[model samples]
Target: MSSVPIADHALLSDCRTAALVTLDGSVDWLCLPRFDAPSQFARLLDDEAGHWSIRPVERARASRRYLDDTMVLETSFRLSGAVVTLTDALATGGEDLGHGIGANSPHLLVRRLECSGGEAEVEIVFEPRPEYGLVRPVLSAVDGGIEVLGGADRMVLTSPVPMRVEEGTASVRLRLVPGRVLLFALHHSAAGRPPARVWPQGELAHRLERTAAAWRSWSELHQAYEGPWQDAVRQSGRVLQALTFQPSGAIVAAPTTSLPEGVGGERNWDYRFTWVRDASLTMDALWIAACPDEAAEFFSFLATAAGPPGEDLRLQIMFGVDGERDLTERVLPHLSGWRASSPVRVGNGAWDQHQIDVYGELLTAAHRLADYLTEIDEGTRGFLVACADAAAFHWREPDQGIWEVRGEPRHFLHSKVMCWAALDRAIDLADLLRARGRVPEWTRERDEIHREVLERGWNPEVGAFTQHYGSADLDAAALTMPITGFLPADDPRMLSTIDAVERRLTDGHGLVYRYLAPDGLPGREGAFLTCTFWLAHALALAGRTGRARAVFERALAQLNDVGLLAEEIIPSTGEHLGNFPQAFSHIGLVNAAWAISQAELPAGG
Candidate 1:
């Protein structure tokens, strides 16, 4: 396990929830019911804690990929004379498979094992550690298989193979013949609750087929988009959907926990929660694919999450899937961090920081989905109006900036532009609403914000935009100028800014730094994946399609074998850093691919 890179992991989800599965047949990270919910199995952050793993007993070669369009993952292990495959997914609700669970339902992990050739020995290990390695859960026999418990938290494991229940864990050794199969189901909940009814093997099989069909059915709706990087674009769309929490349509930042930013440094922060920034971008990604249902749901989540008008909106950079706001940061002192990066943090402390750009991001998303916002409840509208009003007044304040830097707030150039964008979008919304008799004051504030940004944010001497008011540092964030329609991609300033970024921010291989200056904390960081994607989009928009495609291909080369990407990539070695499967990176990939597919590529093999 230590030999495998973190990028080897793939993701599986039930739309309402998700988990991280490694290539070697281990579910290293999972939080039971919701993305922000505490983990029942957190071996990714601490190996000795509880995790459910099944792999061939003998040394073998293993490979994996998603099953068609669905979130279902297939990992095959080949021994010298035998082959075995394992399929994993969370039981989803509704449709044919009946694998879906409600928003408030307890968490579950369903894994199926099949022997494809000859007979091979397989091992099943269930080590349940509680409280992030603080408690050693006791494994006891249960009706179907076994149960591991610590205080109120309960982990139930069900398997067809004979098992050993020992100190704090369960194990099984089985000879998997060609016709033999095993089903392992893990249930997490309070101790006194009735054990969840295990899905019969036949029903589980039916659900798996139905789930695949459902994903394909949903994917068929994307035929409207015929851009150049069609396959990659569509894959990005599918990934966004897979990462989304379907009940509310809110997209999480990433599906994994403690996949360190600095590789065991204190930079590790929980990314399972929904970010206002991420969910907003998700709306744009879904909209580009013509998926209105998802767009509408995310818009609604924003409205409810932003709260009523006039009161300070709890504009967390991130939130729980159910919209819970308090994500208290804590460290697991017992477990060695990923690659020995100490202080594995579970919750995000940035939740309480004031990120002024959130309102702008929220408004931009809502405005993009304005055509669908009308279909949402009236409260969402009120929240939108109220949020607009708050942003109108607060747009001038300094914030933590888009990077969510832990350092003191400065007037980050991007954050300020987004503040203006928030107002601009709100004004656009106001006009759209006014034709039908809605809020008119929003239009006035939007105009005022636009004027203020042009005057205060631009730097004349640099021939390019700077990182903040009066700061000379260049930022890759300047790339958003054209993408947001704030300026034409070919506009003098925009072109000069792109050139400036190319000169200062872009390293030789086309990887982009978030900014040239240090971001308040110690140590260096990887080039941001989203920035490179933005560069692709900007180049495409500026009629540099060939350059755009070249850049796009270079960026796509960074994707892991499973086509998953992290928040940042180490420029030299390409080791993934920051959050794994970052939503912004995926969103950027989708948008850039859409742009690049329209650009012609050079003659290829």
Candidate 2:
């Protein structure tokens, strides 16, 4: 099992793939070519899976931060008498290369180390494990560095210094003087194609400069969020962009798989695939973060991928980055799980689950982007009608809720409210586009859902809305009532629900649980970070500005040192759980901050 805390790792991305670099100068987890590709380094799951480390020989303390407005990470190591800084980034295609900042490039991971103080000794180790540690690659010494060959994959490591290959591993040690620099670049290819040429030290430095500049340029052009939590919102925006699959405009829930929701539990699931619900909300978050282009692109991708709604009008719950629909789940028992969280999984089984709330999310996303859209195509107009029709027909039936619970279906209040939202947005869209559709039917169904939820989904004895019809359970998802405009935040019923949720669901540390009801899963999980943020957003919308800011700050305080958040947080210990740098958590942060900012504005301003 890996010993490193999940929070100890920082992310590096080229918008095509991602690498997780630990503060101790180890690249522990990485996937080549695509976010869901098999790992090239899997030590984050198992210690012997694979890892590459470059750190000072002597013990040292380290501090790290991202470069100004960029994903480039720099870690400073302070030893007894020496200081060294290691810079890490996944190389980007800059304008200088005649491509845009988000263009895909040859898969390359770059690390530059420079000594600024007294002389220091550093050691380097490289162990390439192909197919998630299923194949141990053969390492051969090449002209500049080393070549790793295994299965159908080939990786070339080019370094300024010679590396010795021993027992399939590469090791090197060097003594560095002040102002001296050392650089290493690892290029990957799936077809065993050799690197075009070894990058010289100067060329590597130039690429680093250009990559940093590209990131800065993109931030300047895209990030327009000016809110009270400016820094947090901008950082969240960057994390969201990093999680995006640039080629397809599909935003992954998280870049990792099988990171257990609860340690030593079977609640683990792969999240690398794009969910209709997550992608739709991600589009809304991007719009609020001043990324209108991304929102539009995402909607376009969804429209094309979804094609025409089927007879049932049920869209695929999720899909691969390339829009493939077969996301079958399987377990890897060969490798020990992270921290003994067993049954490490790949793909996701929930892709086939019937999630009724997706229509609402998709339509709401399209409605949000309508202002930026120049014209509505026939395909999109038909898609909108189909979605609204699906909601109208299915809202009365029971299915999995938004949490994708693995148990029997029930009349989840959130799903019903979102069904109302689906028709609500679709009615608005139909009028805006002047498209032919059952607008009257949609309006009737929308009102019917609203009335049904108010009458049946609420528990009179509990004095609040329940998780499902006839159940008194409180759910964090009900907080979306105001967010989706299904009800006024200050409505007497909504206020009672909010107060009841705070009284029953919160952990007294500002962290909120999704729901305490069992969902065919074993073991307990941490408080969901996104749900906590939703509480803050709901509070702000209800005009409790001061309390909302406090809750928002408490949620912000749970982020890791590098301003990254995970799917959940251990409320008692504040240890991050589940997938790292979760896009949903960041989306919640951005949207919550925007809500507070809007609420704080003067009346009529």
Candidate 3:
């Protein structure tokens, strides 16, 4: 944690991979070839890991923003009398590639420098430490540029200003006037792949332009949300798109791994894979922010990726972008985590945990995209039908809850409610999925869950529906009871749950915590940002739009300068914590905004 606040970084993507750039123009976190691949730069986790940075020789006031609707980042650094702008993008194949916009990306990162004010001086630092800072590449000057050789990746750094590099480190300084412009394009090639030709300076600039254009075009055609928090909703839509793996239609929870939930504690976990639960919610959020095409495609990807829905009705809680199973969690004790949060993890052990809530989420996403999925094949149809069956069978059994607690599994009310949601949606989609015969079975189980939740899941002692059956502790997830329509928003029980959560689970601020219960992890964690949005959404649905607006505005204040949010917020400091650019946080933002907008609509307007 270069002590760099997680919120201070901006995201750049070609929809294939992502890079996190700090305010001062440093690519602190980036994974090439693919989002979950070995990092080419891991400075976000440790100081000695590889990083490429360019900044003014003197201190400068920095301001950054995405280029309008696109994911391309533009940062301006102002000093004394000079101002220099840095434009960065991961190049994509331009024009109408539909969902395949980045299918033909050249795996090139383009950073363009331009001077628009008085003369300025800047320095460029090139360091390539591949395989998670384990192998330091030998830098050699080539005809086109510098060739980095070592590890599993060969990187070519092309620049107009020449610099002699002996080891893995290289530095060059350049002076720029009002009319001056410099370009650096770093291209990557892994073993067993034919390496593309080194891009010339002129072509590198051209590809950068095309990448921006492609992103803008993608936004224009897809992002049609014209409601409250329009700017944030649109920006989040781009961020979610940026996190998606183009070829697989899988949405990663975040790009970086091992950013701590509790700084200087052992609470860090990797979030670079496609979580079935998260991806399902992401589909619903994206449906509102963008368009239905992605939602449809994601369902298709899910159907194909999770295997033939298994005779045992089992599916992974999460899967690799390419649908690979067996995600074994391991740690790299070498890299001292951000802020000394040691034991940087690579893979997630939660992937193997029995997260039974996924069935409900998956079927819920399918229900939302039912119209777009009219042409789903029989295999896909059968898979979804099997998912509903799984929910009916597993709703009674308990595994890890939605928070993926490492402790013993209990009867999580949220899991049971989501199971009810699955069966309800399955009944509604019976005709479409050709499973009308199973509706009776699904209905019986659905009603049983509803009855049991109202009886056992609720706590009259606590005046709320507790975290799990018969528990006195409250959970912010209880706020979802109304949002999921399991109970009407204004129902007495749902309102009491909301009031109890606000009264107990908040950080004395508007921000909400997942819970205060021990998660079988050492040390305490920060307030989850997503839970705050859930509070806001619940308030809006419960006819308290005024207070809902206030909560929404308060949560919006936690967004970074560039409108990106992290996974959690430190209650005391109001500082961002956990993984940066978390998809769940943004998804909550988009959905809460939508809920407010809908609630605000005039009666019969």
What's the count of clashing pairs in each model shown?
Answer: 12, 0, 2
How far in Å is the alpha carbon of 411 misplaced in model 2? 1.5
Q: Which predicted model would earn the best lDDT?
A: 3
Report lDDT (CA) for all predictions: 0.75, 0.86, 0.88
Report the lDDT tens digits of candidate 1 across residue range 78-106: 99989899998776644622212233334
Q: Once superposed on the true structure, which residue ranges of model 1 sit more than 4 Å away at CA?
A: 1-3, 94-106, 191-194, 197-199, 221-224, 311-316, 431-448, 598-605
Question: How would you encode candidate 3's per-residue C-alpha lDDT over 1-605 as one tens digit per residue?
Answer: 46788888999888888999999999988898999999989999988888999999989999998887788899999999899999999999755344567878888899999887699999999887888899888888877678888877878898787875857898888898998788888899877876844677788888888887788788888889989999999998888888898888888999989899998999899999999998888888888888857766677788888777753586779988888777799998789899999889999988888877888888888998888889888878988998999888888888898999988899999999999999999999999999899989999999999999999998998999999987998899889888888999899998899998998998677789999986678898899889999999999999999999998998999999888999999878989998879999999999999999999999996
Error of 3 at 17 (Å): 0.9
Ranking the candidates on lDDT from highest down gives: 3, 2, 1
lDDT, candidate 1, at 92 = 60
lDDT of 2 by residue, 1-605 (tens): 98688899999988888999998999999998789999989998888889999999999999999999888999999999999899999988645222255575567888999897699999999998878889888988878878888877778898888888887789999998998888898888765555534678887888888888888877888888886989989988888888888888888989888778888787888898899898888888878775657655676677788877643588888989878889999998876877888888998988888888999988898898888664657666666677888899889988888998888988899999999999899888887646545788889999999899989988989999989999988999999999999999999999999888888887788799999987788899999989989999999999999999998999999888899998998898998899888998998999999999999999997
